[model samples]
Target: MIAVPASAAGDGRPAEERGAAGRPSLWNIANVLTMMRLLLVPVFVLLMFADGGYDPAWRSLAWAAFAIAMITDLFDGELARRRDIVTDFGKIADPIADKAIMGAALLSLSLLGDLPWWVTVVILARELGITALRFWVLRHGVIPASRGGKLKTLTQGIAVGMYILVLTGPLATMRWWLMAAAVVLTVGTGLDYIRQAVVLRRAGLSAAEAERDRER
Candidate 1:
């Protein structure tokens, strides 16, 4: 007979397993913030295209909506972690919200002829591809966020924000370089995530095989 660890609370499972099984409710504050971000996506899109897509006032309002979405993105995950209320709903919805708002901004700018179509395609492709990869390997394990990924997000946000605003002269030129950096970061981090995902999946498969052998 095996002795159950005290941390398992007499259930014979590990504490970590228990924690995963008893995830917090979906209605928590963290998930609410993520939902708010998703709802802002359409609002941002409408504002971006308002006044024939060039009125500075409408763009400013769009920028305000984008900024709020970004700010909430930063807080929701941290709030979930700190409060120990991380939920599956948040895990899935948070990234979707992040991508939706960013994608909407990029697509709107490209449609307005403010940004290059190729640039929008590249960024959106990377974002969507990485998101697909995450779900592909989700049963194995999560690919933890890297510093490069965070930098990519920051650079992309700033570049997009600059484009949303009506700028001229030297500032306009600078935004192009910032966007270039963002594109490079997007591709670089995306490839790194793919590598990590492959490795994680392999490890998870090996562990599963070993467990089956033990059971046999």
Candidate 2:
């Protein structure tokens, strides 16, 4: 009954399930880091708003915290992979953590008038949509992360970083360009994800139909 947010990384496990190891999977090291990342989202948001949205030091600190949290996004997944400890729970938790961070940051920025609501909506929607599509594909087996997807993530991460830093320094004008890049990548990767999702869905339907035919 865990009504987890759509943006949350959902390795498809409920809150209480364990993998083959008989350990509380929610406590798995990798997922624990992901949860920590999720928890940090509000701290960043709070700091952003508490400073009246313009305190340079607070802004810098917020961005630094954000960047550090983002690093965990990379490391946790890699560690899971390298250790062959990937679990369904990890799969779900990782993405949820990522989206929570992105959505929270984007919303905070938009709240302070640094970003427009329309733009934030597009970005947030794509993030959530692609994630849901990913799980749909996952049900069919591993659909490896695409190069374009990685690029999208990279650009968005850096773009958000720049926008935050812009608030801290005098590079305010570049905010528009950073926003533009995030938009472009969001659309591009969203399309790519949709394409893959379609292919998988069609393939799955065909397999299901074929199995039905076998008994006839």
Candidate 3:
């Protein structure tokens, strides 16, 4: 049986690889956009909190920034696919940037009474729990981003954006639906990760048993 080489395998030198070698890696264009998303986080926060009697205007700017960030979330992956610039760094940084921005926005909204405290807590708990789990499982192997996981992220972005944008009356009902979608996706994806983790563990155990049998 042939084992996969850790590096590019020709030179045999692993040059401190951080992201996926695919187009989504740090070299990838998608990841550049992901970095842009991270860069915008501070600006968004500043726009959110620079309230010197222009609270509503600043809030509106914050919403627009959030909207742009969310749009990038969709396009970066598409751009990676189209341009074929995916990388490992893209995977790690993309998600981290996503969670930081969303988490900050949600927390701010909750503080301002735009969203329910429980909703913010639920969203944040899901984000942190998944991130910690990702690192824990990385020791065993890379967990390729699943389709369901991507869907969950899209839902999360939409939900958080809706919550932030619908601060006024009337359209607030739509925001509630978005939040419900996010919650459902979060729970579903969490379960999906648990199942994947179990499968990976079982696969490792089976491989070990096979190796032992060969030795015997």
> What is the TM-score of each predicted model, taking all chains together?
0.85, 0.82, 0.75
| Residue lDDT tens for model 1, 1-216 | 897655454343223433544556666778889999999999999999987999999999999999999999999999888777777778889888999999999999999999999999999999999989988999999998999999999999999999999999999999999999999999999999999999999999999999999999
Using TM-score as the measure, which candidate wins? 1
Q: Candidate 3 residues 1-216, lDDT tens each?
A: 787664455222224322444212354457767998999899888887776413877777888998888888888877765655556677678888888789889888777777789978886887788677767766566667788788877877777776655355766777788789888888888878877777777787788899999999
Between candidates 1 and 2, the one scoring higher on lDDT is 1
Question: In model 2, what lDDT does residue 187 have?
Answer: 94
lDDT of 3: 0.74
Backbone clash total, candidate 2: 9
lDDT of 2 by residue, 1-216 (tens): 778653254444444444544333556667778888988898988877765877877888889879988989989888766645577788887888899888888998888887789988999999888777777777665556788778778878877877776443445666677778779888987897788788888888899899999989
Model 1 scores worst on lDDT over the 10 consecutive residues at 9-18
By TM-score, the candidates rank as: 1, 2, 3
lDDT, model 2, position 113: 85
Which consecutive 10 residues in model 2 have the weakest lDDT in total?
15-24
Residue 33 CA error for candidate 2 (Å)?
1.7
Residue 7 error, candidate 3, Å:
20
Give the RMSD in angstroms, all C-alphas superposed, for model 1.
Answer: 6.5
Q: The CA-based lDDT of model 2 is what?
A: 0.78
| lDDT ranking from best candidate downward | 1, 2, 3
Candidate scoring better on TM-score of 1 and 2: 1
Clashes of each: 0, 9, 14
